[model samples]
Target: MRLIAAGLLLFGTLAPTLAIPPPTKPPCCPRHEVFTECGSSCPATCNSILERNANRVCPDICVRGCVCREGFVRNRDGKCIPPDRCGRDGHRPGDSSEEESGIRCHRPNEVFSECGSACPETCDSIVKGGSERKICTKNCVIGCTCREGYVRNADGECVLPEECPRHESSEESTKCAPNEVFSECGTACPDTCANLDDPKPRPCTRNCVIGCICQEGFVRNDEGQCVLPSQCPNSDAIASSSLLLAPLPECGPNELYNECGSACPETCDTFNGLVENRACILLCVPGCFCKDGFVRSKDGQCIPPSECPKPTGSTPTIEIITPECAINEVYSQCGSACPATCETISGRSPPRVCPAVCISGCVCRAGYVRNAAGKCVPPYECESNPECGPQEVYRECGSACPPTCRNVLNPNLEIACIDKCVAGCFCRDGLVRHHNGKCVSPKQCRIPIGIFTVGSSEELNAE
Candidate 1:
C-alpha cells in the first residue's frame, strides 16, 4: 500500500512537466491529407482530394510519423485550417518514400528510358550505336536489331514469327542464288545449289575430303571451282598420290580414258602388264614392231619415242655387223644410209636384215592423239567441230559439262569451275536455243533486245 501511494504521487507531479506536443506529419507529403495527429479523430474531409482517407483514429490512420486534421491541415496549433491554405501533396520522382524510382526496366536493346530527349526505336545497346538499339517492327521498314529469342521479319521490326523458331539455324530463312552464297555470317543468298559429287578435291569447300553438295572431294570455295585437278589451290596434295601416281582418273568423260582405273602398272615389266587395269594407254606389245621413231636395245628393250631418233628408211648397222642374224633380232630406228628392204649398213654389216629390240614395248598416256609426230595431245575436234578453232581445239570430256553448253569464268578470276569449251556445244547466258545456226556469245546475239520504258507500274506490266 505505501509503495502504491508513492507511485501515484510521482505520476501526479511529473505528468505536467513531461507533457510532449502532438505528433506532426513528415515534410515529404502534405500533412492535411495522409498524416493524422496523435489522439485526434481523422477528419472525413481532411483533404478534398482524398475523402474517405481521413476517417480513422489519429496517429494510426495515415502515413507513419504524419499528422492530419479537418479543413485546415495540422496547422501551427496542430489542428485543421482552411482547405485553400494547404500546400502541395503526393511524392515526386525521387522521394525516399516513393515506391517507383528513377530506374526504368526495359528489354534488351530497348530505348524506353530516353536517349537525350527522343525515343530511340532502333537502339543497338550491344554496339552502343545511336539509341543503343535498332528498330525491329512492321512500322519501321528499315529494319531493326532484334533482342534475344527473336529475329527481324520482313516487316522490318523485331517480332516473333513462327517461321523462325528459337534456337533454329538461320539457313531456313537465309539463302543464296545459284553461283552465290552468304558472303559473311548472317547474310542470305537465293542460290544454295552446290555440286554434290566431285570425285576430286577442290578449293571452295575448304579442302573438304568427303560428301560435299558439289562433288565428293570438291567444295564451295569463296571464289567457286568448276575445273579439274586445278580446282584445288596450288600444292594441293589432292592433285597427286603419295607414290607419284598420276592424278585421279575420271573415266568415260568426253570419251577420254587416260589412267582410268585405280592404279595401273607404270613400268613395262611383263609381270605387271594388265590390259583391264591399263589407264588411257596404247602400247606396242613385246612381239609387235614399233611403227617408227622407236629403238631396240641390246638387253631387249623398246626405247621410248622421246628417247628414239627419227625413223630413217634403212636398217641399223649395230645389230647385223658382228651380231648373229636371227629371224627376230631387235630392229631399231638407227638406219638412214641403208635401203628400206632391210638392207645392210655399208661400214659395219654383211647382207643381213634387222630385227626388233623391244622385249618390253611402250604405251602413251590418255588425252593425246597419235599424230605423225607420234606424240600424244589433247583430243582434237578435227572436222567434227569447226567451231573449235585453234585457240581451243581440245574437246570437252564427256564427264564435265555435257555436249550441250559450257561457260567458264575467266582464268584470271580466283574462282572458276568448268572450262570454257563444251563437249561439242556453247552458248551465252539468258539466250534460248532454237533453229538458229548456233548459240553465240553476246557478241553474236541475233536481236537488238532491250526492255521498253514505262512511266508507272500499271503501264509497265500491262504492255
Candidate 2:
C-alpha cells in the first residue's frame, strides 16, 4: 500500500511534464518540393527557401542540407549545378575571382572570355528586330563556350539558325505569290492531309527548303505556281474541309477519297470488311486501299486476289464464296437458314457452321471463332485447351491441332486430335512415344489454312 501511494505520487509529479508533447517534427521544406536531397556536403553553397513558405517543414537532420533546385542537378559536393554540368566533373561555372563588373549579359550559348558584365535581368535590353525577342542568360560566367544547334543572332539572341529568314545575295527577283516565299533550295511537295491528325513530325519535302516554297495555307499547282489551297486538286473534299473549306465525303481513317482525275480506280466503294491498304493510297492515287492478301506490283497495280500466295504458319485461309442471296445478304446452306452474323447472334439461337461444300452464312469476320455455346466470340475469348486428359498439360486453347500427336496431358487418344476447342497438352519434351499413339514433337504439328476434320486419318497420316 505504501509502495502504491509512492508510485501515485511520482506519477502525479511527472504528469504535467509528460503532458507537454515534444515539438512536432516540422513538415519538409517547401523548396525541397522542387529540390531532391542528394546527400551530406562539407561546404554547403545552397540557401534555405524554407523561411519563404510557412507550411514547409525542415528535415530532421540536415535541415539546411544541399538540395538540387528545379532544372538544376546536384554535384559531388552537394552543390546545385546547371543541367549542362550535371555529368561534368570539376567544372564550376561561375567560380571566378575577378573584380565586380557592370551589368551586361549574353543569352544561352553565348559567352565571353571573362565576366565582362553582370547578367541582364530582362530580355528587353537585347531584342532588336522582326519577330525576335530577347532571352536572358542563365549564367553570368564568360569562357570559350560551344553553343549547339544555335547561333547568336544580330539581335543578341541565341536562336536556331535553320528555317530562319535567309537573305538573298543575288539581285534577281524571286518573288512568289502571297503566302509563298522563294528559297535557294526547295522540296518537291508535302502530303498536307497526312499532317491533319498530328501536327508534330510533319513530313518535309525538299521543294520548300531547296527552292521556292508555299507557306502554310498555300500549295503548289501543276504549272509550278503557288496557289490557294483550293487550287490543289489532290486535296480531297474531306481533306479540304479538315483544312477549313467545304465539307466532302468522308472515308474511314485508313481510306482516302480520290477525285475524278486521280490516278487509281476507286475499288473500295464496295464494302469488303477489312482495313484499307497503305500501298494503294500511295500508288493508286485516288483509291482507298492497301487491301488484305494483295501487294502492289512493281508496275503499280494491286496483285489480283487469286494470284497472292498462301500465308504461312497457322493463319486460317478464309474461303470467300459468292452467295446466291442478294448482295450483303448472309450466306447459308441450301435448305437451312444461314447462321446470323455475330451482330445478330445474341438475338437468335446458337449458329451452326454454314454448309462446307455450299453457301454458308457469311464467313465470320476475321479474328472471330465459334465457341462451345455455338455463339461467335473473339479468338481471345475462346476456351483454353479442353480435350487433354489428366496426364496431359494444357498449353494454348485454339481451334487447331497442337504440335504433338499424343498430348503429354491427353494420352488416351489413338490419333492426334486437332479440333478447335478447349485445348489439350502435347507430350512433355524428350518423350519419344505417347502411351496411346505415335509420339509427335510439338514442331511437327502443322495447322493448315481452311477447314479439316478433327482426328481424321488423313491428318494423322500427314503428320
Provide TM-scores for the models.
0.15, 0.18
Residue-by-residue lDDT tens digits, candidate 2, 262-367:
2334332212323244222121133344445444443445555444444446554556566554333345333233533332222112224443223235444445
C-alpha lDDT score of every prediction, in listed order: 0.29, 0.38
- The stretch of ten residues in a row with the least summed lDDT in candidate 2 is 42-51
Off by over 4 Å in 2: 1-128, 134-463
Clash counts for the predictions, in order:
62, 33
Q: Which digits, one per residue and each the tens of the lDDT, describe model 1 over residues 370-423? A: 333434333442223334221122233321221111121221111112333324
RMSD of each: 40.8, 31.3
Candidate 1 lDDT (Cα, whole model)?
0.29
- The TM-score leader among the candidates is 2
The best candidate by lDDT is 2
